[model samples]
Target: MLEFKTTSPEETFAFGQCLAKVLSAGQVVCLVGDLGAGKTLLVQGMAAGLDIQDAINSPTFTILNVYEASFPVYHFDLYRLEDAAELYDIGFYEYTEGDGLSIIEWPDKFPDQLPDEYLWIEINSDFVNNGGKVNERVIRISALGTAYEHICEELKQICPFLP
Candidate 1:
């Protein structure tokens, strides 16, 4: 497990970009966080690292957004999903198992549907709330398989400033 703290959205996105640089096809990353935990910002950094020049936004309404970069990237938002069954119905398995990188938001809503071998990331806001302004955040990353461990190590190297 890797733990880190960020004080701003830019730092959070930079951390995500570091990880994104190491991502490739057939990789699934589940992001667990609350409503304003910077999940989308992290995804933005990941997309930037992947060399995706297009805009990266939360696919809350569309459910999934596909982008082409160094490799295919499939971004999914499960916040609107009623259950894991809806994920299957939307052909989420195709993305998770296909030749593309899959990044999912609100994965807690579909724990059983999540891939067992996928990487997990949890983001939480620390005590710094004044009218909904977060001053600190905690991000926990866990590697669930050998492939994910390799990716984590690669991400570690992607940013020399990262600890």
Candidate 2:
């Protein structure tokens, strides 16, 4: 597990960019966070790191957005999903198991459907630092299996400044 506190959007985004360097296709990153928790900002930075020049926004209505970068990136938002079964209609399984990097926001809503071996990131406001601070977030990252565990280890080595 890796936990870090980011004081601003830029810092969070930078962390995302740093994280992207260690990402590859066929990997899933499940995100758990509340509204306006910088989830989209992190995704934007990841997109930048992947060399995706297009706008990266939360696919709240569309559910998923695909972007071409160093490798394919599939961003998904489950906030609007009324039922977990809705994932099937969007062919969520295919994308999750496909040759693309999948970053999912609000994944805790469908814990049963989440991939068993993936990275899970939980972002929340850091109220302890809320004194006059506009945005501060505590990001916790965990690896579920050997593959993701290796990735987490690599992330720790590459981004030792993530405190």
Please provide TM-scores, in order, for all candidate models, with all chains considered together: 0.92, 0.93
TM-score of 1: 0.92
Model 1 agreement with the true structure over 71-158: per-residue lDDT tens digits: 8999999998886778767789988999999999998887777787988999987655577777777888899999999977876666
Quick one: RMSD of model 2? Answer: 2.0
Model 2, 34-54: lDDT tens digits are 787888998998898888999
Best TM-score goes to which candidate?
A: 2
Highest-scoring model, lDDT:
2
TM-score of 2: 0.93
Question: Which residues of candidate 2, in runs, are more than 4 Å off?
Answer: 127-133
Please identify model 1 stretches exceeding 4 Å from their true place: 127-131, 160-163
